[model samples]
Target: MSNPAVSNPAASSRRAARAAVAAPPPRPTSAQASPRPVAALSTRVPLGRRVAKKAFPPAVMLAVASLLVGTSVPANALFDPDAPPASMALSSIADAKVAETVEVEGQVIEAEAASDIATTAASRDAWTVTSYAEMLRLRYGSTNYSYNASGTGPIRWPFPFAAPVTSGFGDRVAPCRGCSSYHRGVDFDAGYGAPVGAIADGIVTAVGRSSSFGYRVEIEHIINGQKVMSLYAHLIDNSSVLTVGAPVVAGEIVGAVGDTGLSTGPHLHLEIHVDSVPVDPFAWLVANAG
Candidate 1:
């Protein structure tokens, strides 16, 4: 044992020299070392793989969703990876259809509206519509299209809009007692009280009532250098205010739709007479009306 106060410089120098020459620490053995943390030695995964779950194709996602919900999925639905969702595809088709319809309608107007607009709705809807591509239907469809277009011609259809024909100009069973089995006029179901118009520039030849026709009106016009007569019957009572021999222009209001004189329902019976012979009113109007 050494005294507490005694200084040992030589001993300290010898101890420092020994420590400097000491052997390096023994390398850690596999068994003696502590095990590494599980997180620190994790297997490397690709960064792209981490984000791939969200990048699955829509079809594949749909199949998986269907399975999760216990719904059967079509086999073809899962195979297509490039196809868009059905809603998106349908929306795109709708947009294309609307665009094409607009273009076709504009072109149709330019082609049909040469001298008058009255001919456009009637002619385009009747004839040229067949020539158009079947897929590109008119935006202003037949039911919605009106015949109110101004006409610079001597003739026009009687109504402001196209009225559906209830009865054709031909032989048919009588609709009511005292009604003629052999039809002489075309019956238009233009709704009750619908305004009737003159088919052409003409003078009122006759206006009266009868047992077969509730209220009748007759007008004579010189069409294409021939005497053409038009008859409107089954008009509402007291609707024909114009007296006999009153001047009327094309599309002049003559009367209103009504059920009278052996009629079953409200409708207009239109007749066309050429050379005192009854002809098909529908055919004559379609051929001659502007």
Candidate 2:
């Protein structure tokens, strides 16, 4: 109903009323809030593996491989090139024109004694090497000396061979390995059954079969008013050419050569003795004849 507006003072003002709307929505998380501190989580297995690799390195395997290779080498391979040379040393004989005699292989190599041209008389006292038990002394003329100074002797074969050597004198040979016993004779490597003649005129003294010397024969001769004896060893079997009392001349065939006793091969072992003492046959040959 319409009511009449009366007296106007207070007026009931009539206005249109509108519905209230909400503000805009906020974000899902707070944008301006302080962040929280995170807790630390340790990974120990990877760190331990790294530390083990550093402590026991792959280089240890390489070192072990090198040591194994070094131990496998042989010891003898180190010094095989240092062995001694095999060639033997021998003393050389030069042109010995001036010297009366010289030593070769511990025996005297001598020439003939000086002869007087006026009467052809020979001087027996020329040169010799003293053969003794302890030492060897070389004597030249009347003067005696040693090898290191100067000396001489007769030409003698040092080694044994198969031949006819007339003079049997001083041959230095060891009967035993350590003992210094000489072969008091010159051996002739004359073939078996070859004729062994007398080197000088001598009388047969002993002829018999011996255990050490086989069929042996002894001859006694005179030289420069001195008695010299000759011994023949290892004669031909059963071939008798002389009796014990028979006299033989130089170069007279007396026996045959054979290998009978204390011999390695077929040869004639001849020995010459002065007053029953052994002397170098080569020296004797030079002194008696040129």
Taking every candidate in turn, the Cα RMSD to the unseen true structure, in Å, is: 24.5, 24.8
The lDDT of model 2 is: 0.57
Q: Which candidate is the best by lDDT?
A: 1
Best by TM-score: 1
| 3-82: candidate 2 lDDT, tens digit per residue | 55554434533311111224355655787766665432343458788888887867898899879877986776565566
Question: How many pairs of residues collide in each model?
Answer: 0, 18
**What TM-score goes with each of the models?**
0.48, 0.41
| Model 1 Cα lDDT, one tens digit per residue, 84-171 | 7765565555555555555775554443333243334345656633533232233212222223424446788778668887777655
Candidate 1 regions off by >4 Å? Answer: 1-152
